[model samples]
Target: MGKIVGAAIVSHHPGLMQCEEFRRAMGAGEDSDLIAGYSRLRAKIEAAKPDVVMILDSHWFTTGYHLVDGGARYTGTYVSDEMPWYLHGVPYDYRGHPELALAVEAVSRERGGYNRAICHPGLERQYATLNLIKHLRLELSDTPVVSVSSCQNCEWQHFLASGDAIGEAIRRSGLRVILLASGALSHKFNGIDWKPNHPRLFHESNVSSIENIQSDKGAIALMADGDHQQVLERWQDEYRQLPWEAFGAHYLQMVGAMGGRECRAKGEPLSAYENARGTGNIHIWFQP
Candidate 1:
């Protein structure tokens, strides 16, 4: 039977695409330690050898209902309109898991989550999905993938339910899967003109919250115990207001999809750093 062999919740910043020398020249590498941390994460994923990687991309924003890319092949060039200088002319090609995507949509709908699968050839893959291949060296042909969007108009519970439904569907379909929540923990950016080779800029309000999230070990602990409600409450009260990408729901979706009942800490904390705009980027791994 197909099973979820492993899972990860990591940062997906455009800065991760820079060369080591560029990262050094920019002086951003020292503070975040993202290279070493992600290196370890990549090794762990390689060892798992999962059949597919399902990315919960925060950059994908759908209205009203959740959407999945049902295309059999995903190919595109992603030149970040926001920062073409840093991310221009980037190309990506990946094999898609259309059957599994449709399964997820049907299961989510049955669970009352109301998600759908979409197929549009020649569409550009968003940075949220592209960064997975670019930074982690994940090949789509080797490990087929399905991309899910974080809907714009959904309640907190809806997000959690969708995750649970996806997890169940993956199990039912017997496909080995990995869940990746691709986003930052805190997200207050400097103006677009900020240079790349500088210490990340920080806003006053989010700094402490970023630090708090870094220190909190209960994220995995809460999910392991099936205390998703507590996890949700803690996130809202402690870190949600700090302006995380996708309101930090990406992490919860991952936790809930793991069945939200592990009841013990399973994650190995990885790295934490500030994004270009002074937001927190944390990485953690769970082996279930």
Candidate 2:
């Protein structure tokens, strides 16, 4: 049977796309730990040797239905409309796993959930998926990859259901997979006028507030302890109140696929928790 070999919640902040000098300058003479964390994550993924890597892309927002990229091949140059100058003219070429994606669609339907695989040639790419590819050095390997979108209108439970369907589909497909939750936590941003006050932009001090930092750390601690149930329990009462990136759908879906509240996979800290323009970002790997 197909099984999940590895999973992780990784940061995809735009700053990581910049050159080392720029990153260091913004990080108070330190490159973002996430940059180095990518190399470490790469090592672990190589060891797992997954047949395919599926990224739950927080930025690839869709309405109503959760979409999966089912294209056979995608090759292009991309420039982020959100930050064109920072992430511009990046070339990407990768094969897609349409079979696995279609299977996910089938499983979702059988479960009365909405997951549709789209193989349209004109479907655009998002940085949440592309950034990880660049950082993880997926371009150097032949591993096929796919991107799953976060439904903007879905509530917490809906996302979890989608994940559960994804998990079942992976098992039936018999393809070992690595799922990457590509987004951040407590994603409230500093106001545009605050740049002058926050010279060291990437430091924890620059995070939106102390409360945000504390909330993020608390969630991280639970993941490290393999206490996903508590995180989900606190979602509505606590964490969800904060402006989590993409409503934290990336993480919710990833954990949902792992058996939701029943999952006991502990996370290893691949990188220290850091700040990205007031958002909480880190790399924590969960072995499967």
Candidate 3:
């Protein structure tokens, strides 16, 4: 049977897309810890020997369906329309896991879940998914990758139910999977004019507000303590107000698949918590 061998909540901020030299220049002589975090995350994933890498992409926002990219193969040159200058001319070639995606869809259907696998090759890719591939150097490996979209209208429970379907699918398949929740924590950007005054762009001080920083730290601490129950419980009252990246769907879905509030996967931080244009970003791996 297929199993989720490992999982991670990782940062895929566009800042990581820039070359190390430019990143160091922006950081006042230090590269973003996320740059090194990718290497360490790669080692952890390698040790898990996962046959498929499933990404819960916060950027792939769908409205009605919890969409899964089931394309047989993906190949193309990419440039971010959102920030073309910062992330451009990136070539990607990766195989997809159609069977596994279809299995998730099937399980979702069986469980009255909303997950749907779209096998069309023409579907566009998102930086949230591609950045991880580039950072992890996934093209050098034989493992197939697939991405799942976060439905824009989904509440925490909807995401959890969809993930429950995915978990059931994984349990029935033969592939070993590594789940990547690719996005940030608190995801509010600073006002445009702030950049000129803030030369130290990547520092935590650049994060939107001290409150956001504390909220992010609190959530991170909860993850480290393997206390997702508290995070989930406080979502509607405390955490949800912080505007998590993509509604925090990436993390909600990942933890949901691992048994939702009952999951006790302690997080081992791979990168220092940092700011990316006022957003809270970090890389943390959860042991399986």
Candidate 1 lDDT, 135-181, residue by residue in tens: 77777336787888888887666777778878888888888888888
Candidate 1, residue 192: lDDT: 55
Model 1 error, position 144 (Å): 0.9
- Which pairs in model 3 have colliding backbones? 2-173
In candidate 2 the C-alpha lDDT for residue 287 amounts to 96
Estimate TM-scores for all models: 0.85, 0.98, 0.98
The sequence of per-residue lDDT tens digits that candidate 2 reaches over residues 1-288 is: 999999999999988999999999987787888998999999999999999999999999999999999998889999999999678999999889999999999999998998999997568999999999999988789788999999999998899999999999999999999999999989998787766335666667778889999999999999999999999999998888996888888898899999999998999989978888778899999997
True-structure lDDT of candidate 1: 0.71
Best of the two (1, 3) by lDDT? 3
Model 3 earns a TM-score of: 0.98
The per-model lDDT (C-alpha) reads: 0.71, 0.91, 0.91
